[model samples]
Target chain A: MELTGAQILIKLLKEEGVKTIFGYPGGVVIDIYDELMKSDIRHILVRHEQGAVHAADGYARASGGVGVCLVTSGPGATNTVTGIASAYMDSIPLVVFTGQVPVHLIGNDAFQEVDIVGITRPCTKHNFLVKRTEDLAKTVKEAFHIARSGRPGPVLVDIPKNVSVTKIKYKAPGPVKMRSYNPTCNPNKRQLQKVLELIKAAERPVIFAGGGVILSKAPEELTKLAKRTQIPVTTTLMGLGAFPGTDPLWLGMIGMHGTYRANMSTAHCDLFLSVGVRFDDRVTGKTDTFASQAKIVHIDIDPTSIRKNIPVTVPVVGDCKCTLEELNRMLEGVDLGDLDKKRKPWLDQIQAWKDTKPLAYEQKDIIKPQYVVEKLYELTEGKAIITTEVGQNQMWAAQYYHFDKPNHFITSGGLGVMGFGLPAAIGAQLACPDHIVVDVAGDGSIQMNIQEMATAVQCNLPVKVVILNNGYLGMVRQWQQLFYDKRYACTCMEHAPDFVKLAEAYGASGFRATKPEEVESVLKKGLSTPGPVIMDFVVEKEECVYPMVPAGAPITEMLLV
Target chain B: MLDADKHVLSILVENQPGVLSRISGLFSGRGFNIESLCVAVTTDPTVSRVTLVTKADQMIIEQIKKQLNKLINVIKVHELTGSPFVEREMVLIKVHAKPEHRAEILRTVDIFRCKVVDVGAEHYTIEVTGTEEKLDAILSLLKPIGIKEIARTGVIALFREPK
Candidate 1:
């Protein structure tokens, strides 16, 4: 059938089963917006281009589908860079469409023209420029396929203005050919056997689960392996919800800011089965000394990530779910003789370490960040899905909140992007409407994408945003105080808008928690509200994330409070 | 050390305007030296293809591959020393003959599978198609008599099977 480029785009999206899209229309992309008006897909008009992309990212993360966003070129395309990068780092699937200049004026630097393909190359899985009207259908189909395929990532399609206006006979192609892309989901049998052998032979075996476990939805298998082998599990910051934190075998997070017991146990374990984790610097403090006492077995989907950071004794490259299934099968017949006998001494040492320094917070007139996090944990009974913004709030959430299930604790660990929580909470709430989706956001990070409050209000998404107001970029201030001799340049914001007023302006219920006693009541009120609500908790300004291993120091050499 | 099947290549490079000098300088800088060298561009255009015959073993060929990857805008390069490939050369011979022996020479041309593209009263331009050795044989056959002019198309090759 003869179709315009815009109509072809709508048709392609319809074929892909896309029900909704988030974007803001401008000069170049009006053709798409006009075509969208004639289609059945729901288009959400966001306040800003950044908010649009973030909302799309949120939708993708929550729905487990490719998030679609359409925007004009130049600033609209440039504004989506942060959101695209966030998804790229986290390996979320997203398909972004950008309107380009006319074909004739492409090289002449026409109005609203930018080389988006070149700018986004490193941050995307793959990208294409639709020069011909006939290529639109194929490009759009391929974009979604590439974005949602194995090891998912964002893909951009830049459509020229004239191409969108041109008429062409469009028939959706079956599939395009890509020679270099291959994603393996099943573990090699020999490698799986080696991992099983390592797990069976080791006396003190610890399963270090990361975000991949949650991403692959392998929590049940992980829990089964942990219970069957009687091996304790320690999670990275991103891997928090992969196993129940309340389980006796759960050792909590292990990293620079991890629990004392968890960190020490990880350092001392004989066999470290690192599953679905990249061993980021935050997790492995000093590379030379990290897991020095352990023999490493790494399982990951990406082969390049196997020995990229830390050397692995046994490298099993495959999907976490498939690998764990194979492991469960291998362990079904093997008798783990007297598992308690092997773990008794190690458990005693770990308990002793936990007893030595439990996660503690001092109660003072000024509300400490940890105290607020602990109070939230107490009030929610550890049932709420907690999403965190970057910096101090994220670290506090990681330190205090106990996640009970997979998908319970979502944070931007690899990207460390601020302004992630509010939109992510919106997406999470949309995904699990019955559950309480709480975004633990810092004041600085909250303002980055606070406009998402509009999205929440429009959708009536019941997301409770708890803003930890410290009056400074708390994490940066801590860095400056510790390393930069307290210069404190640009770290402190003298005149900040009242968050309660900001929340009110966005048409959401607002509350303030000033004293320690008010923390619970304020959070309860915010959580009890029918729709989106914001609670501005006045937190201590100078408090920092303790147990910080001075950037390059060993994890053992932590500076605890 | 050259392989038993290795062949020597002779290439003509244009000496005009430091082009030949630049080409030689490039070869030496990249640790590749020419075994045989010749110069001059033909009448058609203001360009030249430098021909350098080298004794490149397999390892040396690999090194040359690496160096060629670094060159900016070098049109084309290939190793013409393998089987299952076709190689052809063209030679134009202007032979002096009397009118009486013209018929006999034309008959010889037909017997040798050559074409006379240009014919003057005294000289005939006979074009022969064959291997370099066969072309040399034809040139040797005409050496006893006067030969006016000669021109040749360089050895170009194509793989027998599709690449």
Candidate 2:
């Protein structure tokens, strides 16, 4: 049957099981949106193209599916760059479709024309410019396949206006097979044996899990290996939920702004099994000193990430889940005697460090941000899908919100993009309708995407925004206070819109808590009354996130609260 | 001179728009230096071969190969620096030929097995092809005769198949 390129795209999306797409319409994408209206796929109209991409990222993280977004060319496409970069940094699977000018007018820079594929080349896993109607189906198929494949990242497909409008004989594309792209999914048996031997011989071993564990859906296997081996687990910020926070073997996030016990344990461990983690500078305070005493074993799907940052003794290149399964299976055959009994001394040492300097804060009158996050976690039973804006609020949520399951905590960990939380909460709410999705935001970061509140209200997504109103960009302020000798330097954001009125203006419920005692009541009211509500807690203006490792310092050395 | 840091990689890629940009972007984005690059369509019309030369340590060379492999357009990346290979580069050097030095220049060109591809009233444009060292040797010999202009196609390499 003859079909337009736009119809073919919609049909391919349906075949790929893409039920919803977040997008905004413009002149170039009108044909695509027109075809979308005739199909069953739900199109969410976001206020800005940036909101669409962030919401799609949130949806992908919460649902564990490839998030898809659509936007017109030029400014609309450029607006999604920040969101695309964030997803790229975190290795989030996303397929972003941008409308372009006609193929003949492409280089002419006609109306709404921009080289989106060129602009997004470095940030995308792959990209295609569909210049012909016949290439649409295969390009779409490849885009989805590449986006959700090994070491997943954002992919862009730019469809010109004429291509979208051109009609061609439609035949559904078969399974995508790229001769150039093949990801190793299975681990080598010898590598697994080597890892097993190390685990058996080492007196102190720590499992350092990262976002790859969650992306590969191997948290169960990771937990099993950790429990079976009795090794303590420390996660990167992105790996917060890969291991249960309540487990006795759990060490809080390890890095700059890491827990005292976690940092000290990393510094002291003998065998470090780093799973699905690329050693980012933030995670390793000083690369020379990081895991200096440990014989590190690195497991990741990407080969380039293995020895890019820190040298490893054993490098296992494969999917995280597959590698962990192989390692776990290898463990069952090995005659490793009584791992728990052997690791007692190491565990005791970690516990001693934990007991010595636990993560702590003080609150008397003004609302402390940490207390607010703790209360939210308590009220939601640690089950709320918490997305966070950047800065101190994000760090606080990562510290206080104990995620017991994978994909429960979403944040821009790698890019640290502010204004990610609110739109992400909207996407999460839409993806998991029954779950309570909340954006733990700060007063400074929330205003970056405050306009997205309208989309949440319009779509009837009951996303809660708990703004830690510190009246400043709290993270930078804390840094300036610590290192810059209190020369504030535009960090203070004193004059801001009253969040309650702002929420009411957007046709959503708004609540505020000024005193410590009023925090719980405000939260309870905002969460229960919700068809999208904003809860602003007037927090301490100068409170710093504790246990911060100064720049270039070793992870073991931290400025405690 | 061949050094441990200098590497030559022959990359097979899909012949499509912006593939070169993607490859070059990867290099610049990671701060990896591309000393010289040559690309053209191979025997297979759909595939293009990119011959790239980079200067990096062993670890970085491995990373550069892995990162190049990660690109969707790239089919295969083979390092020719460590293998028994044949490398060729062609240079067009236009040297000022005075009446007194004409015979001497002709003798030098004959020694280098270079052809006089183009000749003007005052200059001779010689075309030479060989290994990098051969090209450099001929250029040094001709530099004394006051070379007018020169253009070079960077190194392209192929590994010798074992008999």
Candidate 3:
């Protein structure tokens, strides 16, 4: 049947099993939006174009499929840049559709014409501008394929206004196989043998997990390997849910703000089995001393991630799930005497470190931000899907909340994007309707895209936003206090809006907790509200995230508070 | 420690717009220096090959290749800096060649296997294609002849298969 480009887009999305889209339509995308109005595919009207993309990102993270979104031309297309870059940095799978000025007006600088493909080239995995109607289907197909395959990332497809109204002959296409883009999936047997040998022979072995394990859905395989070898597992900020956070072998997170045992174990381990981490600067401070004594084994789907930051003794380029599965299968037959007995001393040392310098914060006078996160964790029974905006709020949430499963803790790890949590919580709540979803946000970051609170109310997503009102840009303020002797440049947000009033204006219930006694009551009330709610807790203004390794300092030598 | 070394990088990429800008932008963004750059389409209509030379340490060399590989358009990257390779660069020199100085100019052109592509009343445009050193040597030999103008194509290289 001959169908308009908008009709074909709806058909394609349906064929791809996409049930919902987070978008804000404009003049150029009106046709697509009109078609959307009549389709069964629900469209969540986001308040801003950035929120649309980020909500889609959160949806994709919560659900293991390619997230989809739509936006308009000019400023609308440009507004999505931060979200696109954040998704790219974290390697999230997303396909963003943007409306463009009609084909003939693309270069004429027409009213709303912008070179979106050029703008997003550096960030997106791939992008396209469909000038003709016939190419729309294949481009859409290719965009989704590229977004989800190999190392996943965001892809954009810019459709002109005329193309949406043009007629096209549609024929469903099969899976795409780009000859130039095949990714290696299976780990090399020799490399697996080397990993096995190191694990068996090393007196102190530690497993460093990253986001790739969650992206590849390899938690079961990773758990099997960790259990079989009795190696302590520590995750990066993005890899929070790759292993059970409550496991005894779990050394907390590792990096600038990682736990004491996690950082110490990584610094002194004999063999470092790093699966899917890119050795980001934040994670491997002072590269020369990062795991200096260990024989580092790096396994990732992307070959470029290995040895790009730190040297690796054994590098395996393959899917995390595939590599871990094969490694576990191979280890099933190996006899390594009693693995737990051999690792006792190492585990004991790690336990001693954990006991020596446990993560602690003093809550006096004013309420602490960490206390809010800990209460949320306890109140939700460690089951609510937690998303966080960047800075002190994010680090505190990652530190206090223990996730027991994959896809539970979602945050912008690589990009450290503020204003991410509120919209992301909406997406997560939409993806898992039965589960409670909360955004642990800071006052400064929450205001960046505070408009998204309307989207939650409109969609009735029932996402709870827990704002730790610290009255400052907590992270940057901490840095200024530490490095610049408390100059307090522009990091203060002394006069912030009343969040409770803002929530009420958006037709959502709001609650505020000013003292320590009110934290739990406010949380309980907001969570049980059945509809979207915002809980604003007035937290300590001068609180600082602990276990900070100063810039250029080794991860081993942290300035623990 | 920035212990840098000169290395030649050959890459195969999609023959499309913005790719060159992306690669160059990456170099500038990462603070890696590019010594020379050249690009042209390969046998495949949809693909283009790029050649860029840069100076970097061993670690930075790996970084350059990995960053290049991360690009969606980049198909493959090959580092052929130390291998047995053949390189060619073409230079056109317009040197003053008076009637009395014709013999000397012709002799020099013959020795360099260069052709006098354009001949004016008092000048000759010599076109030479050879390795960078050979081109440099020819330019030196013609420099004292009151050279009027010169144009050169950036160097392109290929690995010389050993027997």
Candidate 4:
């Protein structure tokens, strides 16, 4: 049957089980928007194109499905770039749709015409520009597949306005063959045997987990293997919820801003079983000096990631869940005799370090960031789905908050992108409606995508946004203070919008807290509110993210205040 | 580091505007200077194949592969190094020739297995197909008398067996 490109798009999304989309309509995408009006899929009208993309990102991360977004060309498409890059860096599955100029006037520089595919190429996993009406269905299907497949990332489909209006026979192709896109979900037997042997032979073995464990939902398997092997486990910032933070074997995050004990244990361990972790530069301060004493065994789903950052003694490329299962099975009868005795020295040293240089916040007249995070954790009882914006606030949330369940904490760890929390909070709330969704955002990051409050009000999604109003881009300002001698170029925002007024303008409840005593009350009020609420807490501007290991420094050389 | 042996690369990219810019940007950003870059549309209108030549060692080639794999529009990248590959280059040489030298030019073209595609009053455009070095030799032979203009189809190499 003949169908318009717009109809084909809607049908394709419906076939992919997409129930909702975040978008804004404009002249360029009027045909698609009109067709969408007749469809069953729900579309949330975002106040800005940036909000649409971030909301879609949040939806993808929370639901573990392809998040969809639609926008017009030019500024609409350009505005989504930051969000797209954020998702791309974190490997979130997102299918982004942007209206394009009519085919006839594509090269004429017509109104609202921009080269979106060109601009988004570096930031997306893949992109397509629909030239023919017949390719619409196939392109849309391929976009979803590529976005959700191996090492998931955002994909963009730029459909010309005229093509959307053109009618053509829509026949969705059965899966297209991509030879280069082979993703292995099973571990190689030889590699698994080698890793198992190394684990058994080593005296002190530690399991280093990352977000991949949570992405693959292998937390149960990871915990079981850790318990059976009696090995200590350390996680990266992204791997927060993969293992219980309160467990005895758990060493809370290890990195520049990680706990001193976690960093010390990771550095002193003999056998490092890195599972589902990328060993990002932030995690491995100096590549040459990172885990200098450990023999690394890296396991991940993507083959290319193996040994790409750090040299792996045994590289097993497969799904984390499957690999852990195989490893657990292989270690069933092996003898790990008195390995705990060998690890006692390392553990004792780490404990001593922790006792002396624990994660501490200075007692002051004003409320500390850690105190605010800890209070939020206590008030919510560690049951809330917490999302965080980038920089100091994100580190504080990760460092201070204790996560008890998997997929409970979402943050942009790899890309360190700001403006992720608010929209992601929206997506998380939509996914788990009964759960309390709290977005811990900073003043700088929240303002990046603050316009999403309109989406919150429109959908009546009660996402409690707690803005740590530090009056500056806390992370950049800290870097400037430490490295650039406090040049403070554009990091300081002396004149900024009143966040409380901004929230009220979006038809939502707003509150501000200047004192430590007011934080819990404001947060409770915001969370208990029927609709969306924003709480702006006046935080100290000059506060820095401590326990920072300068770039290329040894993890043991972390600077603590 | 430049290697003595040259490596041929075939990259499939989307047929979109500024895609070339993205490709070049990647090559330049990573300091992998392309020796030769040629782009042409494939049978599929939406796809284009770019053939590039670079004098890179094995390590640099691996780095290039990783960097190219990261590009969004780049569908596939293959390196035809030490492989049974069919390498070809097309060179159109316009040689200045009078009526007296026309027969000699024609004879020379016949001996080199080249074709005379266009013949003007004072110039003859001889199309030569061979390796880049072979084409260079042919151009050198034609340059002594008088050469007007030259156009070349940069090296496009394909492996004899599937990778």
In model 3, state the lDDT of residue A513: 99
Q: Summarize candidate 2's per-residue lDDT along B1-163 as a digit string, tens digits.
A: 2344888999999999899999999999999999889999999999999999999987788899999999999999999988899999999999999888788888988999889988778988899999889999999998988999999999999999997
**Model 4, residue B160: what's the lDDT?**
99
lDDT of each: 0.80, 0.94, 0.91, 0.85
**Which candidate comes out best when scored by lDDT?**
2
Per-residue alpha-carbon lDDT of candidate 4 for residues A42-131, written as tens digits (9 for 90 to 100): 898888887788788777767778899999998989989988998887788899999999988887889989989888877888888998
Q: lDDT of model 1 at residue A6? A: 90
Candidates' chain A TM-scores: 0.96, 0.99, 0.99, 0.95
Give per-model TM-scores: 0.77, 0.99, 0.96, 0.88
Sorted by TM-score (best first), the order is 2, 3, 4, 1
Interface RMSD (Å) of candidate 3? 1.8
For model 3, residues A299-380, the per-residue Cα lDDT tens digits are: 9999889988899999999999999999998998999888768999999999999999999988787999999999999999
User: What's model 4's overall lDDT?
Assistant: 0.85
- Weakest 10 consecutive residues, lDDT, candidate 3 chain A? A171-180
lDDT for each residue of candidate 1 in A318-354, tens digit (9 for 90 to 100): 8999999999998999988888887788788888888
DockQ of each: 0.03, 0.85, 0.56, 0.26
Kindly list the per-residue Cα lDDT of model 2 for residues A1-561, writing each as its tens digit.
999999999999999999989999998999999999999999999998998999999999999999999999999999999999999999999999999998889899698888889999998899999989999999999999999999999999999999999999898778899999998889888887888889988898999999999999999999999988899999999999999999999999999999999999899899999999999988999889998999999999999998998989999999999999888888887777876688889999999999999999988888999999999999999999999999999999999999999999999999999999999999999899999999999999999999999999999999999999988999999999999999999998869998999999999999999999999999999989959999999999899998999988888889998
Candidate 1 docking band: incorrect
DockQ of 1: 0.03
* DockQ value for model 4: 0.26
